[model samples]
Target: MKDLDTLKYFLGIEVARSASGLFLCQRKYTLDIISEAGLLGAKPVNVPIEQNHKLGLASSPIFSNPLAYQRLVGRLIYLAVTRPDLAYSVHVLSQFMQEPHDEHLEAALRVVRYLKGTPGQGILLRADSDLTLQGWCDSDWAACPTTRRSLMGWLVFLGHSPISWKTKKQTTISRSSAEAEYRSMVAVTCELKWLKGLLLSLGVRHHKTIKLFCDSQSALHIAKNPVFHERTKHIEVDCHFVRDAIKDGLIFPSYIPTKSQLADIFTKALGQRQFEFLLRKLGISDPHAPT
Candidate 1:
């Protein structure tokens, strides 16, 4: 293949490069979503979902058209590729796709409205960012109104640029908040190892111990302490894995205060002020906005 110009757009993502760094956004994709949803000229919202909103299976009337909700959620999932700020909202709405409810549809629409506020908002990878791996892991305990499963959220940053993140529902019900946090750490540990391997394959030198920040002291203690007891027996397997990782010098787990936990934005909805704060910290900004 002949050499082509630099990548300006690919698979709905619009990429802009400069001396500062690369700015990637999906403005057209998001606008199309809003247009298809008939939300043109709709009033924009600051946050995607209401703070502490607990969506349940039996919350409202069944949506007449399941296919419509499914289609919208499907598109939102793709949009999340460049809009990590919308990750938690999209993940929450996707859960209701099998059996759509009017409430769920409304929530999804709110996300679109939120998008209307700043469709150009996307990730920024600074040119001067370092190569050191940094991660933040957090969990929302017993947040689901239906399954009661905890939500685990983590972000892996390569230097100042966030390279990976996920918001997932735990596979098993956790007995305590600490248990949920510990399980979240376990998930992050696995992700970190995979990322390290990927970096090594690429010939990138990142031998410095990866720093993993978690807000749960109990979870860190459980991972560091070798002793297992009746309280942590249910999650002993995960404990051992985390302990081994720490012992092997793969990751260094440290405590970060809740307010400073960037991963908090992924596990639960926050008020507009706090949500925007975390959004900025995540390096998501509206490229079209005034400096």
Candidate 2:
């Protein structure tokens, strides 16, 4: 086997190391996407998607080229490997793959334009970051205009470096916001457990209790108290494992105010201020920016 030495690039991810930590981005890949979308010279937006977007099953004209939309979204799905900021937008647009509409393609192109602004932006894994596993989960209740299903999202951090995150639409309908948030808590809890085990196998031992935060006090209450069973009977029995994790001391669930909810970016589109603010919070930076 040929020894390639230190990793510089792998599967489109460009890696760079410095005194602070390891940085990864897809500058070339991003540029290619922008060019393919014919937006290399388009003005960039402050955000990937507009807040309160109307991207649902509507009577709008079907896109002339459905394959183009599908291809763009597929590339974007890979792009999100290092660009979590684009995840929600990609997820939303991906739903119309079978039948992309004009508005959907516009939204996809908007993402390509956004990339033109900072194609080299990526997440950082700081060398000085502590080995702490913290997580935040949020759900946008009934956010889908078509299905009325809630979108659940979460962020898991290894100290200051974000390790894992996802935005997924809940399969079942949630009767209340509390139920939606609680379900998101369950999703993040599973991810945390899986990550903890993976880290342990990699020879990193986490001594501190894993902390999971959420903005819904009602969901927090449901996880911390058994009395809520009567109110949560409709919730799947499997989701109840979140409470078990708490009881077993595997995770500590806490309440965070809405404004401090970093996972909100994953659950729904947000204003420019909140979007950029969360990007900073997520440890994303453009290392290629001019000094």
Candidate 3:
């Protein structure tokens, strides 16, 4: 192992070791964002989005200059790299990039305001936590108002530290929630398989079958079963890939209840209480806490 002084950074996220473990806040970068958006003194918010709020393609008056909205949204997207808590909200606003309105701009500013309050918050990568790889996957059925596309989200952890995650709209629409979730599992399986290979190359050996937790029983059945019918025919390709991975011992997709699904935080909006619960589950610290 290299000396403590020699360790600089990893994956663009700076590192600062301490007696406890490592402190990993991007305060300087976050401040720069706040300054750039002229929101350094803006009122801080408790949450990224208001309770029960719905945002969709605006049918109202357009902004005087759409580029201004685009610029702000662009900055928020960068902020989300270390703030998975804001992923779903940022993504929802991003869909309005083509023609954003005053309301959408205000909603995006609320996220910035939230960031103002929690600028020091970041994932804590404890030194002694087990390095075993574990993951959770989830999806929201027909969550997008315009396209009716399901949102798929997954988070991979090296012990308690989240190393990778994604929140994206499925490429194809699904007829049922089961199919939407199964497609998400397939996506997560493909990612886990690649990560396994990469880890092996780096001499980080792990079990042959990486366990992947999902919140859909039907999806798990489809991956574990070989039967193909009309309901499963449309997603034949994804089904085959996931099943093949299971057969080859590359990934083991298991069932997890919706309440415990960590990936749900990324796939859609939730009530404030549920959102806060999932946020803590993702290992994000409370910025308001005393340092």
Error of 3 at 284 (Å): 1.1
Ten residues in sequence with the least summed lDDT for candidate 2: 227-236
Write the residue-wise lDDT of candidate 1 on 1-291 in tens digits.
976789999999999999989999999998999999999899999999887676665568899999999999999999998888888999899988889889999999999999888889999888998778888999999878778999999999988988899999999999899999989888988999999899889998778889999999999889888998999988778888999899999999999999989999889989988888888788888878778
Candidate with better TM-score, 2 vs 3: 2
List residue ranges in candidate 2 displaced over 4 A.
236-239
Output the lDDT of residue 97, model 2. 96
Question: By summed lDDT, which 10 consecutive residues of candidate 3 come out lowest?
Answer: 6-15
lDDT of each: 0.90, 0.90, 0.82
* Runs with alpha carbons beyond 4 Å of true place in candidate 3: 1-13, 286-288
Query: What is the Å distance of residue 90 in model 3 from its true position?
Result: 1.7
| TM-score for each candidate, following the candidate numbering | 0.97, 0.97, 0.91
- Model 2, total clashes: 0
lDDT of 2 by residue, 23-78 (tens): 98999999999998888889999899988789886568998999888999999999
Clashes of each: 0, 0, 0
